[model samples]
Target: MTAEHYFSAEPATPDQRGEIAFNVAGRDYRMTVASGVFSAGRLDPGTAVLLRKGDLPDAGTAGTFLDLGCGYGPIACVLASEAPRAVVHAVDVNSRARELTALNAEALGLAGRVRVAAPGEVPDDVSFDQIWSNPPTHVGKAELRALMERWLPRLAPGGVAWLVINRHLGGDSLHAWLVERGWQVERIASQKGFRVLRVAGKTD
Candidate 1:
């Protein structure tokens, strides 16, 4: 079997596609999944926990949001659906993941609100009111820290970031690391061995 990383710029695996159905916030989602993307088989467990435990926006919420490392658009779609007035940027390193997110957003009539893009494609001037992520911890500590360092500073003033990490995957250490870097980190929930962290900029 070929070892494939979901963060690969281009997955060498054949695009064997399928569908996954999940429910979040009383709404059901059916999205396209394929080989080479993260959690192509189902809604990822950490992601599922994040959605269930994190404070999701409502229909009246209005602002720019970021779905960092969006796999097949589950978090992106949910954000767009829950916050009708918000614009969601779904970003991923994998081209295949971006394609699937676009496809799913279009299928759900959220194409106008959900902007799918590669990490670098997001404009540097854009800032997020809220950032949601189930980061690629498999990428190693340095790479993961780099990813957070690259994006966390882009949070708008008073903005918050929601993240879910597997406990065994350095979740506690990550919380400590973020605090050490001056961000206020809170472990909001722990379920199924996953830690749901709510992070925000420190106030003066």
Candidate 2:
């Protein structure tokens, strides 16, 4: 019984469904949207920027990927579609979001590769070669930092994370924070007030 925000473990609101149509990397996508999910109205601008700016893995790339805070599985589907050899884990706190992600993955015929789950359902032994997120910055600083801490540490050695944050929403500060914590963070791109960060594990 958690609260009913988009970050809630179980949202109490009925799912009044909608759909968002967009194209990514020359491919068209029309994903399922529902009430109580993040960015149900459209593909979030930050996510759009991240997907456009980040260097997505190619078909030959093979590894485990994590789409932390995946909403309706846009990132997950894209990742799976781009790199058929890779496996994706789409984790979200919102149960409805998880449901929509699973449905969307199935719709895309990616159910065999995209594993949707609640945050706690991820296996402890699993780590990721790539982590992609447009995290919930509105979830407050403490919760946001905690979210990063829990997952960022699980990045496989030399792996990278692609993240997008609204520039006005502590984006610069979050970049600094990650630097202080020893990650090599770079502002890969910025558009529409969103900063795309390429976060890599420390090598030196």
RMSD of each: 1.2, 2.1
Question: Over the stretch 4-99, how does candidate 1's per-residue lDDT look in tens digits?
Answer: 568898998899999999999999999999999999888999999999999999999999999999988999999999999999999998999999
Instruction: Residues 1-204, candidate 2: write the lDDT tens digits.
Output: 123467887777777898899999988998999888888889988999999999999989999999999988899999999999999999998888999999999999999999998888999999999999999998877888899899998999889999999999989989999999888999999899999999998755
Total colliding residue pairs, candidate 2: 0
Question: Could you tell me the lDDT of residue 157 within candidate 1?
Answer: 96
Off by over 4 Å in 2: 1-4
Give the lowest summed-lDDT range of ten residues in model 1. 1-10
- Which residue pairs of candidate 1 clash? none
Model 1 clash count equals 0
- Candidate that scores best on lDDT: 1
